[model samples]
Target: MNLKEQLMQDMKEAMKAKQSDRLGTIRQLRSAIKNKEIEARQELDDNGILGVISTAVKQRREAAQMYSDNGRPELAAKEDAELAVLQQYLPAQLSEAEVRDIVAAVIAETGATSMKDMGKVMPQVMAKTKGSADGKIVNQLVRELLAG
Candidate 1:
């Protein structure tokens, strides 16, 4: 089954198990997906759904960091929980080492010997990593690789 089908099944299981936290997170995700569909006037495939989920995850991570920084552990914990739930649907994340390796390969492939070649290297690295790697990390790796 596809990601949406898997989400529906998980939502049902969450309901059956009386896992309110999990159920609520799933409902919120579904609502976000529905909103995107309405806004776009098209059904999203797995990749599009992933983009939405990825956005949600990024938001949660940022919110959690802000809350933690502002001395709000309880709220930070809640955001962290939601982030964990959202990440369940994302593809496994690549380690920094793995991302660095990909950046290195792209740099080599594109002959990016200097920062000016960054424009040439980043898109290729991001394309190869897709949503599996965080863009910020990839970017940092690219810059580091190019600068040194």
Candidate 2:
């Protein structure tokens, strides 16, 4: 089933089961997807839904860090829970070695010789690695490859 349909089904299940937390998280995701659709004036496909999920996960990560710094473990835990829920929709993440290999291939394809070519290399690398690899690790790999 598509993301929106799956979400609606899950929402119904959550309601029946009285899962307030899960229901709230799913509702928030739905709201995010709807807002994006309204803004763009187009319905979101699976890729767009994935983008929305990634953004929600990122926001929760940031909020979790802030909550932890403030000694609010309860709030931090909630954010972690939301992040976990969002991650359920994401594809399996790439391993570090896999990401490195992909970056190397992109660099070679782009004929990127030095750090100066990072801009040229990065777009291709990121397009290949998006949602699969961590951005920081990809950037570090690109930097190493360029420097070497």
Q: Which candidate is the best by TM-score?
A: 1
- Overlapping backbone residue pairs in candidate 1 total 0
Tens digit per residue, CA lDDT, model 2, 4-68: 99999999999999999999999999999999999989999998898888788879999999999
lDDT of 1 by residue, 1-148 (tens): 9989999999999999999999999999999999999999999999989988988998999999999999999999999999999999999999999999999999988888999999999999988887799888899999999999
Winning model by lDDT: 1
TM-score per candidate: 0.93, 0.91
Span of ten consecutive residues with least summed lDDT in model 2 = 128-137
Global lDDT scores for all candidate models: 0.93, 0.89
Which pairs clash in model 2? none
* Residue 73 lDDT (model 1): 100
